[model samples]
Target chain A: MTIPDTVEAREAVDLLDRTRALVQPELRGACDTLPGPMRRVAMYHFGWEEADGTPAAGAGGKAVRPALVLAACQALGGDPDRAVRAAAAVELAHNFTLLHDDVIDEDVTRRHRPTAWTVFGTADAVLAGDAMLALAVRLLAEDPWPRSAEASARLSDCVIELCAGQQIDCAFEERPPEEVTPEECIGMATAKTGALLGASCAIGALYAGAGEREVRAMDAFGREAGLAFQFIDDLIGIWGDPERTGKPAGADLAARKKSLPVVAALASGTRAGAELAELYRGPMGAAAVARAADAVERAGGRDWAQSQAAERMSKAVGELARAVPDLGAAGGLLSLAEFVTRRNR
Target chain B: MTIPDTVEAREAVDLLDRTRALVQPELRGACDTLPGPMRRVAMYHFGWEEADGTPAAGAGGKAVRPALVLAACQALGGDPDRAVRAAAAVELAHNFTLLHDDVIDEDVTRRHRPTAWTVFGTADAVLAGDAMLALAVRLLAEDPWPRSAEASARLSDCVIELCAGQQIDCAFEERPPEEVTPEECIGMATAKTGALLGASCAIGALYAGAGEREVRAMDAFGREAGLAFQFIDDLIGIWGDPERTGKPAGADLAARKKSLPVVAALASGTRAGAELAELYRGPMGAAAVARAADAVERAGGRDWAQSQAAERMSKAVGELARAVPDLGAAGGLLSLAEFVTRRNR
Candidate 1:
């Protein structure tokens, strides 16, 4: 149960490898009863094949969430093998949100291929996502997991919170600029991004017979980790290299996305904030995007976001330290948390 | 417990009325976190308010699904009061599907008002639907009932099957006419419609500690009832008057929906079949829709669908008889089944 280092995190890698085998088959098995086009689109997203149902590879995601689940279970004196299904369930739920989020965001590409909606159409994508969520719940319900009742309840609450958070995100997009405050944005992000991560860790701990207080502490750690991850993601959305980020630099600027950094800067009331706000108020074009990025930078948005991310990362690590004293096999959990907070892409 | 006749069915109706009081507040409590516009749309769909968020009476649905759940429990000599939360959960799940389905189908109106999607936009509508689904699962998991594990598993499985059925329905829309068979259409309808109803009855029975055989029989009854209900709906989709159906006559025709009746006629090799296929090959204008409706009729699609509906209804009655010989206080359940098949709208 030795924890692997960041450079040699083969345990985490193997967990993801196992996750692909465990989850993709169940997913495909569920979709096998469906018609061809839907099966194809869903399969493609699962990284099994192409839109035409051709054999393909390297279409998988980073498996960040599942790794956290397994790692947290190990950290809490449980075998990762014992928590594999929980790990798989969390990943399935995570992907479910991604599929639907892509549709809601109207993003055509994911992981360097046409999205499920783009390939099979939006309705199919929506249903496929729904199917995945249902499968996640089913997996948790019918299993060797000792606390299926508690796990299922936790998972359902996370999902509901996730959707409510998504609704807030969508509604905020249509509102006037002043309506979205930094605190509100943080609240939305916490519910949207943090809830599932928290639930994942809590489920893992619950499976391991962790005490209620211990489970809550693990959940708090995971939640803080998730917020840190999202905060860094917001920073990366603006300032990261295009090659590393997989999209164009300043893409958030072009989309006029009010990320955490942007919101904080906008609320700062500096001259640069006024300029950034003015640029955002008008239609976002190429030149406007360039000027807006510059304005945001001058308003200290990037620095402020970086500092906030650092603070969150510190808080997350502190919580993790408080929750798991021995570390043991969960030392990998620490590495995974660092990976999430520090990753460029 | 004494069985109530249609005139005395008001007793069950009274139970439903009382249950609605509990559900409405809980439903709103779950949705309170959502932003104003999205909450407004959901409120409208919940029949709690008008599109403008103004208070309005007479906006609610019949709550038939919940009634079935409670009645099934009562029929099995279980306390209907104990099943109230689950009843609300099923109804919420039903509305969740309806909200998402409207968006996927590009439907602007439902229950003679603008759909949530049309009023609040697709993203918000989708998120709201997702929230409802999560809330439904949460309620099932949290509700204080005996046999909670079995109930949770049944609910999750039903939701998964429901999504699978929806995926097949969407996939059917994209397939060529030759590939769309009547059996396939029936399977889709079962998955989409039958699964939830079956799950509702089974869950209620399970909560009541009904024998496994009885639970299975109740599920069978629900499945057959759902098929019968859908068949009648297909018939009404074509021939029922707009005043009765609440939709324009031939509305399904204009949409070129591959419903049961249409699929049945397509399977039959006849002159009318050829004409119907030709008409469905392209968009159906008003005149073309009328022509297609006539073509289906000439091909005996109308008569064929009616016979199918009657056969299914008979089978459903037989299953219900086997499930609960006396049916006790659920005499209203039998009447509801009959009413479902006979309803014009």
Candidate 2:
């Protein structure tokens, strides 16, 4: 069941693309009843328009969560179409979080244009996010999944934890540098990023009539995958190619984001930790970010983050191994997991 | 089984007082996990503390929505405790909307204190509101109602419509005033204000094993009551006592808010409409608000709102009559509806 390399990555992407084509129209139809401005803002965020509401193409990101959902359902011996609504629900929830996250993080640009908050105002963005969250839940509820009640409940639980995780993240931002730990960072990432992905897989399995044990295993697999995904993300934040990342190199360092690598470095309590702390305490600039990045690299922070990513990747594969030992579709999932954790973009 | 008017309003207040006591601790526990500034801002919005988070007494508003939920359950022959979590869920959802509404409206004050965004910054307020919304949904999903699945689905539907309603509301604010109509305003109010209230009553009825017909009737009752509530609120917004309202009289007019009454007057295109259009076209100062209020009063806006309130109250009562004809403990519910639509405060 193990996927050997990136060959299957393109297939996974194709599956995701097909899923998006099926769901995008439905998603747009749901918003048609909304007020014009709100609908326009949502359409813009969903990559259907320019900020001025002019028609456009390609506003959405990779529909990774939905792909995982449909693949897991198929791998578990269920028709992927039966889980299409659920897949769309998870994707909508993911994008809703992204929209809010952009505003909360004060990120002005997304997908090479102004963020929703910048164009429509934060108030409008807040309402739009709320609307999308509600829509996600409704989509799940309306879908004809087996054990619909349980699946709906699972989705709601993930949303709640997602919010709590976000709260924990924002709370961490304001704390003195000493309060942040690698463990705390991981905990936040698991809740904020991992919980929904895990729930997506678990719910898909549940819909496929997977037993409780298998569901739990899939949950663990997705959670581990999410952690690995985030660890790699943290790494890329510092050292990713500008062309791939679409941001300046070392953007995380420039923003003084207390990411996994920085937390690990500080936890090491080495010379790098002292220098990192001083850099964090001061106003972060381009020069400061470069210096801090160099210091962390010199002090083994990058190596530590890489090791953590490798460890989590192994754990993710281990969980998938336990969850689905003999399924042919498992290869694609494993390959996708690897791609998620190792991709430079 | 109708409760006698001899039963004082204090009796209803006492039930809410007790429910508040039970929920306040839980709400505070959730907020405590946030950063210091966020916690303080949330506390202030909850009427728990000053802007700085110092402990204060008698700061919270009436827990009306929770009380309605509990009362509806008891009246419909269900255990109030079984509905308590849902009650808290509805209340939290209501407050979550309030927090975001304050931000969207850019109101500097709420419950006679600096608004959460004004005190904690807009980012914090948005995050806090989003967190509360997530918590509300979680409470409903986790609460072990007799029909937990149905209840969860119902709640999710309500939240989505509520968000849509808010979107419509914000959209209206930016458009040319002429583009908005009284019918559109009512539609927005029904979605934004009526949906959750209707869901609360419907959930209560569902818990009580009320058949679909009964649930539909109760939903209608709640929706009518909610519309009535808004109509009366519009009346109060222009003329209620400042001491009771915690704001100056005619605050909505002061802000040029397009409430139902104003929309009605504007749609009439009479002398009052002309005056209102003039005042709304420019910045509304104290004199303008006073003049507009006088014009509305003269042009029958106030009377028209009152008449609409009466019609809605009658419709709500009729729905209640069909839903629970025997009355029984639902006596309290009937009284609660009347009280909600008639309250001066």
Candidate 3:
């Protein structure tokens, strides 16, 4: 597909297409080494194959995390080609979380397909996820790169944070909405969503042989951008167009999810916030979902999330500038960060 | 604990106690770095603390895998001290599997206490297990040892095999009793149980700076011994004293578990084999379980398993001799191999 400069995200989209060209083979090769059952589940999860073992039009992720890795490496004047394996490893780790998260959250649809757990049994999905995680670590451990050990350690630490994020998120769901503070919600989002993105950039920087200060800055950039992306994603979850998102309107509210906006609304100290809390207390019909969405908007949740996302994007750009003073040299990283948060879906 | 020379397994018992002393601090230090929620779950699972966050006497595992690591290092004339971190990493990986297996199998008890899942919930247990897997990798990645990277790679590969073994085992549980062959059962046992033990010994050899050939031999020794250990464990599952085993008599039959002996009996071309198959078709009460056990014995499964264990033990000794040249130099490893398969439980 031709990506012209006429589109705002054309550069990022072109970079993603190129990243897929480079990293997909690595990802597929690593997954191919898994046992037959796990390989099938992983292939299906990545949209490389249908449930019947037939090839499919791969509807896998957008390769955003991998794009960050390559772009971050290139931004530091490092060869992006040398970081393809690292990029693939990050993608595998990301998908591993997705597989297990779908099981934990009981999510049915992902990337416009039935979730792996819904297609395969829960046990199979979990085991396949386990294999992917080990595969990810193995990829780094076996890398000939000088920084592979540090990359592996950082990746492992990032996954532990991701687990903590997931554990806290689950615990939050079991508690009353009014009892959960917005600060805790943001902390969870940072760990759950921001961590892998940060690790991708940090690993890329390590591959670049960047100094500690530069690596730290690159990590912060990706993390802040990731949080911004999550905020936008939460907004889309509530108010996105069904035609574009392929999700029912207010589906998160219908499930009583303690999402960023929902939690913000619950703590807004307004009558609408009380109403939103009451709605979250029991099963919700479509009408109730619409009311909850309206309540969130009236309680200043929608505005707060919008401002926070914009603030996070600015912070991300500042951190990127810290690492790459000549912004012209970091166009790809900037474009990718902007592209993730700018998506309407 | 006094370990007298007269007792058959005294040397092995002494080695395990020393291994626990050396590896427990490393294990605890790694667990201490986990996030609060995951740390709590892990501590409880390891019998380091009670469910309520108070300290408890550590009734954790017997340090069998770690003991093998140290002993293998000693057998190859290497300093066992250098491999303590690797040993701890292996133990962490093993416990990670135990946590997930309990959740998957829905087993309610572990180490005479309620399982982590039963106490905390499946979500927490699963997250905690995921954290531990990453922690295991992280420990090796952060090690200062020259061969830490290779060890990490081997451990990760072993975990992938472990997942395959577990996946196959769960698949077998869903099939008919007569459908699972004895060979398939043994293969699963090797993959599930033998792979980690093999990796442990191989890593120990690596830490010792042993050549590849010696490492391979050490791994084979551990694998054969692990298979023998499984055979003996399967026997104890059926005919051992419940008081010693901490399980009820005929428990495997009560659950209709397609264990090695059970599969061997079902595959035997005898009247008793047919009788056992018929009994396996439905839930077995106490009397039916007793009759099924008697039929397994009549079908020659007992003798076959006993002989198989002895044969594997002989192979394990041969492999050890190949690695160490002089059998006297490998007393520690030999004692460990003997101790595992010789246990009544």
The collision pairs in model 1 are none
Tens-place lDDT per residue, model 2, A1-345, is 123246766666566668678666767776554556668778889888877878888736667788788778777887777887887778778877888888888889887778998988887787788777777766765665655556766776677567668777877888976569889999999999889879888877877889888888888888988998998899899998888777799999888888888888877778978898889889888898888898778778799889888897788777777778884658757766866776656
Arrange candidates, best lDDT first.
3, 2, 1
**Interface RMSD per candidate:** 2.7, 3.4, 0.6
TM per candidate: 0.89, 0.87, 0.97
Error of 1 at B107 (Å): 1.1
- Report the number of backbone clashes for model 1: 0
| Candidate 2, B1-345: lDDT as tens digits | 123343545465566677677666666666565444555666778877877657877436667777777777777888777777777777777877888888878889776677888887776787777767666666665655657556666776787678778878877978877579889999999998888878888888877778899889888888999999999999899988887776798999987888988888877778878888888888888888899898888767888999999999889888888888886657667767766765657
* Model 3 chain A: worst 10 consecutive residues (lDDT sum): A1-10
Model 1 misplacement above 4 A: A1-37, A175-180, A246-248, A278-295, A327-329, B1-38, B174-179, B241-243, B246-257, B274-298, B327-330
* Most lDDT-accurate candidate: 3
- Candidate 3: true contacts recovered, fraction: 0.87
Q: Which ten residues in a row have the lowest lDDT in candidate 2 chain B?
A: B1-10
lDDT score at residue B269, model 2, on the 0-100 scale:
72
Model 2 complex DockQ against the native: 0.41
CAPRI quality of model 2: acceptable
What TM-score does candidate 1 get on C-alpha atoms? Answer: 0.89
Q: Is the docking of candidate 3 incorrect, acceptable, medium or high quality?
A: high
lDDT of 3 at B337: 88
The C-alpha RMSD of each candidate to the native structure, in angstroms, is 4.0, 4.2, 2.0
